[model samples]
Target chain A: MQYITSLITATAKPPPDNAAVFSRWFVNHSSWGVLMTVDGQGFPFGNVISSSDGGTGIPYFYLSTLYDPTGMNALKNSKSCFTLSETALGTCGQADPQFPKCAKIALSGDVLRELVSVEEDSKEAAFAEAALFANHPQLSGWPKGHNFTVFKLRLKNIFLVNKLAPARYVPIDDYFKAI
Target chain B: MQYITSLITATAKPPPDNAAVFSRWFVNHSSWGVLMTVDGQGFPFGNVISSSDGGTGIPYFYLSTLYDPTGMNALKNSKSCFTLSETALGTCGQADPQFPKCAKIALSGDVLRELVSVEEDSKEAAFAEAALFANHPQLSGWPKGHNFTVFKLRLKNIFLVNKLAPARYVPIDDYFKAI
Candidate 1:
């Protein structure tokens, strides 16, 4: 796991109560997390996927329908959620992963696939490529035949649990506004 | 994350194709992972939870409905999945988290809550208590008022992705039979 965090940029953790800034920092520093999607049977399926924020609070993904159940499931039903634990970032210290102070966040939203042709030179494609490759360099080398596509979460609810109290729902506007 | 692995027992890695041995070794050494459940809105929700097998290869959990959305969601709809990534074990090295060789697993089943009265000297209660607390000692100190219950996945499917090929479905019997 130390190797996993070597790529995480050094970012000071904001106070636990500061949902907007904390959430932004969390996503920015996290490169991978569980992406939950409703399966064809309607059961929740959690899949490990690489992600990057590209300094934006929103998470972007590089997925291939040919190999990923998550991507296939998302195409059928966009309802999805992405979750990250401080455990993954190696910052939870000795706290139990589920411990509130260990910090966890769930970004609930629909997975919107971008129709970007990287070979055709579109700004959207450029942004998507940079967002993913900058953080997940391996993704850039995946077989092109896998038809990996860029997807982003159309966030509707941001759930942050970082303290002893109940989880807080950061206003969606505040999430985007955070530096 | 080095501290996180300190608690993991020194279990030798089973070969990639040995799904049963590998899955068991993976789960036995791992203490926590994402537990996915269908939320009230029928969306998939993944929550981080502590787990243990007590060397039985059957995963067990200590969950409190009063504090865990995963526990509450299980009560409403038993359909669920538990996912673990080798990345958490510090065994994946530099492979992308989604890399097949990094080894990930998902156990899909219904979460069956066990009715155990530890105070009443039930063997089931004793097993459940030891299963979780043995791996997650902090769980024993959690507030008793949280009304934590023991739950187990009634495993129907064992999905393992440990190679370049498509993920494999390990027969349920093989999983339980693995040492």
Candidate 2:
């Protein structure tokens, strides 16, 4: 068994040029982004929301119904765009964040309620709650009346800028399979 | 003049609870965000964009017409929102970005060609260019044919979440005056 493990480790190298690997790495390291949704007025409103992927690279959010306009906007319009940067990861070094070499990403789609204990229909919701509370422990202590919701963006477009020249469109399938 | 400088520094310290100062400080320290705009499909599209603000705290951007859909989207629909997170600043320490202690800001409005060099009529454009180039030096060397345009988001709503409560609306005048 030890020999088999060593053999797999030695030969199973991930492709360095894989776009999906890069995308997941960029997002997994990032903790926050501007979550955007259309407001009632049709104006696009972006708000700061902390997100964690539990190493799955799928973004999950903790939103306050009593406070965050993003939560209000999401219930009104489910569509959203979540953005993050390598600069936020602090690995961009001296490169300007605007520099293509510094890397950035946008995940756009509908921000839907994926997890609610009241739903009682989803094991995924239970796992998500565990993942979120693990990363954002403060959520467990938030006031009960504030009515916080756990949401996830169902991404339709994955846009990433990790190098010079044009940005890359990473396929969701490839992204899920990268790791 | 030296004594006057010392007097101002000693007596004119900004209040720690000032939302404007917090907003400006957060954005000024951030290098990139999800710049959201309405795409031709009417779905809100978010793109990763690097933005820098001058000492005056107005954000300026260098965008690629060949790459960022956001730049093109901005031309079609000027209304946009620029979002930033203090977690990106690495100053949140152990505080979850959602902890309310970690400040986040959203500047919403029109992302226009107000600062393009072609607008020779604008002195503000000149300052914006200087500020962007000074802060993001890599931009100065980008290709000429890419038709990179410098743009600015004309701020309409300045929203901030810096504490464990509802969002704070920082007035444009107060945002400008929070020295």
Candidate 3:
């Protein structure tokens, strides 16, 4: 399976419009991001993972609730944060990663499990399954015993810095609309 | 001032060696990473930041105690985690970001204050300043009042995944030696 992935790169400098459109563009085009959750000691633990689709502005994961610490952390405390860097896509030019223009965003929200046993619709599950498989075909063939279930972070707040100083907080409603 | 940066892409795969060399390479070549700390609510908060030359295998940052929450969190509880991804470098080709072969590393350590007032860094301070400026020359010109002082993470544990399951743990000594 072919995976087409790239960070924001150097050319596409979305104007700093404070529009949810740029946030949506950054989130959807990127292939993977770091997921953070509170650990047993109450410390933040972050892990790199692939999302099913950023186009929808919601990130999907194939997680084993019993396998990864992130899952365990989520089960213990649903409050979590997801972060992505436009520099990771390699578009920041000579700018430092922290350079406001390099573009960094953190979405604070709750990560909830969506399984066939708990969800209302079988069709939504199937659609999600197909999306996950299409984006990460290899995940579809992983060991069945891993018991990987799908999870998504429903975002509540967005903190973004795309240029210069002073980061912007994107409202949840505006973010979805822009996407 | 021009910068030429690209995620680790199109290069021949490293020899499936889950060695410290590969991990060090990924860290040094990547310009920025996500730094995580415990928030007031005990949730892990992550922000993207520029790291000085990773060639030494130790990431140094210029942060403002009055500005970034990462600095505030560090002052409260010195422990933190720094993460970098080959995917950020645009490498890994078609592999998903979570793929073991794509290389993701989390360096768990303590964030230390390195100002001349805090420690007697006689020579070490100068070396660090030069390294930081060489890799991130733009940072040197920022307003001094932002109080962006240099800080470095004293690595305690290395969680690296370069090829497959069972992430490798590179000892601090081993990591430095490889660097």
Root-mean-square deviation (CA) per prediction: 5.7, 5.6, 6.0
Candidate closest to the true structure, highest lDDT: 1
lDDT of each: 0.81, 0.73, 0.73
The clash count for each model shown is: 0, 0, 12
User: For candidate 1, lDDT tens digit of each residue in B47-138?
Assistant: 88888877766678888888677788889899999989899999898998988889888888898787555544255556767768866787
Q: What DockQ, on C-alphas, does every prediction get?
A: 0.62, 0.64, 0.52
Q: Native-contact fraction for each model? A: 0.67, 0.76, 0.62
Which model scores highest in DockQ? Answer: 2
Model 2 segments more than 4 A misplaced: A1-16, A115-121, B1-16, B115-121
Candidate 2 docks at the CAPRI level of medium
State how far residue A121 of model 1 sits from its true place (Å): 12
Which ranking of candidates, highest lDDT first?
Answer: 1, 3, 2
TM-score of chain A of each: 0.89, 0.85, 0.85
Which tens-of-lDDT digit does each residue in A1-179 have in candidate 1? 01122333237877877788888889988888889888888778888888986775768888888778888999999999998989999988899997888988888999878765544435555676777887778788888888788888889988889989988889999987776
Question: What is the C-alpha lDDT profile of model 2 across B18-114, one tens digit per residue?
Answer: 8887776666667777788898766787776777776566777887666578888888888888887777667777887667777778898888877
TM-score (0 to 1) for chain B of model 1: 0.88
Off by over 4 Å in 1: A1-10, A117-122, B1-10, B117-122
Error of 2 at A5 (Å): 21
